[model samples]
Target: MKLQIDRIINEEKIEIDEVIDFSNVSMPVKIVEPVKIHLNFENLGKREVRVSGEILATLRLTCVVCLEEFDEKLKIEVDETYIPETFIENRKEERPIEELSEFTYKGSYLDTFEIVRDNILEFIPPYPKCPKCASKTEEI
Candidate 1:
């Protein structure tokens, strides 16, 4: 979802509860339901914003060994600081090792959908196993 950061730029802090559309979420596995995202944004200063939230969804994942599809809960905590591109340009020259790892936003909006998608994908294991399959493998 696209969050309007400009709205909270003047405010001290803001809390938002939104339901994201996972029906069109592109994933390696299948998302059986929509995602719920609860976010708190605070303006660190004029040029910086902090976004912290939780992404919750249920997914249909296939077990690698058994090859059976099963439902699983996907929950990921997101805590990121976003700054302008100019901030990176200024800091990049100071310390090359430190690097600019924080998220960057352009204009008045921040596209949070990509962040949510990436975190969810990273949370998934390369090899997924159901409870039954995991128990069977443990006995071996």
Candidate 2:
């Protein structure tokens, strides 16, 4: 989902609520269901935008303990800031370490799909377990 930078700047804030299809994209893990995202894009001056919202999705994962397939529901809260790509070039020398950690966008649009994909990947469990195995472990 690409959003126009100009519109966000003019309106100061934009709210998005939709289900996005990622079947065509190559994802590291299997996303069994469409991703539901409710996001707020707020222009924070100087071409910087703050993206805050929630993402919900179901992922098909393999349980490490039982070696069975299971669906894991994810509800991730997002709070990120994006700066213009050119800002790096302009303030390379003066930019602080923390500022360098923010995401950057180029040209006239902000590609939110990438951001959503990255966050999903980051939130995946390192060791996934099926409900049966999870409950068994808890009982131990």
Candidate 3:
């Protein structure tokens, strides 16, 4: 998912298309979704730039009762930006998940993988349900 942005950074628009890894994520993130994040960077500035477009992926959810994997698709439209000020400064520097906040280009360039990955995660469902399936422990 390493996106080379050298060409896109210098231009008015750059298109990023690729699949990202979710295997290392927590339970739900690992269980559901085939992550593919797409980005189109534009609305450029000397020190700031915008990243926009869609995130598309397929999610397979297992029913609680039947325990069968069900198929679902996800597509999320994105509109976000990055500034040089907020980008990662050092690879060795450890950062909190929150400190990882703020969209910015690293090494004077945008890292497509990081930007797209963050945006896609924002669209992840907090609680996913299987339409035709029921929860094992029914709620009163």
Candidate 4:
């Protein structure tokens, strides 16, 4: 996941049309494809930038019933908005991101590795199950 941040990108928008490999990366959750991101940026009047976007990706999950691994396409439409730590304390009228109509948020711009870690963790499903395969537990 090599994301190129905008040099003058106080505000920027990007569309990702690529596939990401997850097996090689050690993630807390299982993902099977590259997530397509429709992103928006805001300068927030600081050295830090804010990013909001939608994430679209498929995941390989073990059936909750059978405990067998399978592929499940996940279309996670995210609307997360992240800003610096200072902003969060001052911000008001904040609802939990998961409870909101969309997945939105606030965070500081971490270095490349930290950014990737946060993104992957944020979207990774805690318990993944194949909709069609959940009940077919017996070995085939």
The candidate maximizing TM-score is 2
Candidate 1 on 9-73: residue-level lDDT in tens?
A: 87757787877777875678788877788878888886688879898988888899999998889
Name the regions of candidate 3 deviating beyond 4 angstroms. 1-6, 20-28, 31-34, 62-69, 86-102, 133-140
lDDT at residue 106 of model 4 (Cα atoms): 37
Give the TM-score ranking, best first: 2, 1, 3, 4
Model 4 spans > 4 angstroms off? 1-19, 85-120, 133-140
In angstroms, the error of model 2 at 46 is 0.6
Please give each candidate's TM-score: 0.82, 0.90, 0.61, 0.54
The true-versus-predicted C-alpha distance at residue 100 of model 3, in Å, is 15
Per-residue C-alpha lDDT of model 4 across residues 16-43, encoded as one tens digit per residue: 3434455678765666665555545444
Candidate 4 — what's its lDDT?
0.51
lDDT of 3 at 29: 48
**Ordered list by lDDT, greatest first:** 2, 1, 3, 4
Number of clashes in model 1?
Answer: 0
Q: lDDT of model 3 at residue 16?
A: 68
Off by more than 4 A, model 1: 94-101
Task: Write out the backbone clash pairs for model 4.
Answer: 20-34, 80-104, 81-105, 82-106, 82-107, 83-107
Weakest lDDT window of 10 consecutive positions for candidate 1: 92-101
Which pairs clash in model 1?
Answer: none
How good is model 4 by TM-score? 0.54
Report the number of clashing residue pairs per model: 0, 0, 0, 6
The true-versus-predicted C-alpha distance at residue 54 of model 1, in Å, is: 1.2
lDDT of each: 0.78, 0.90, 0.62, 0.51
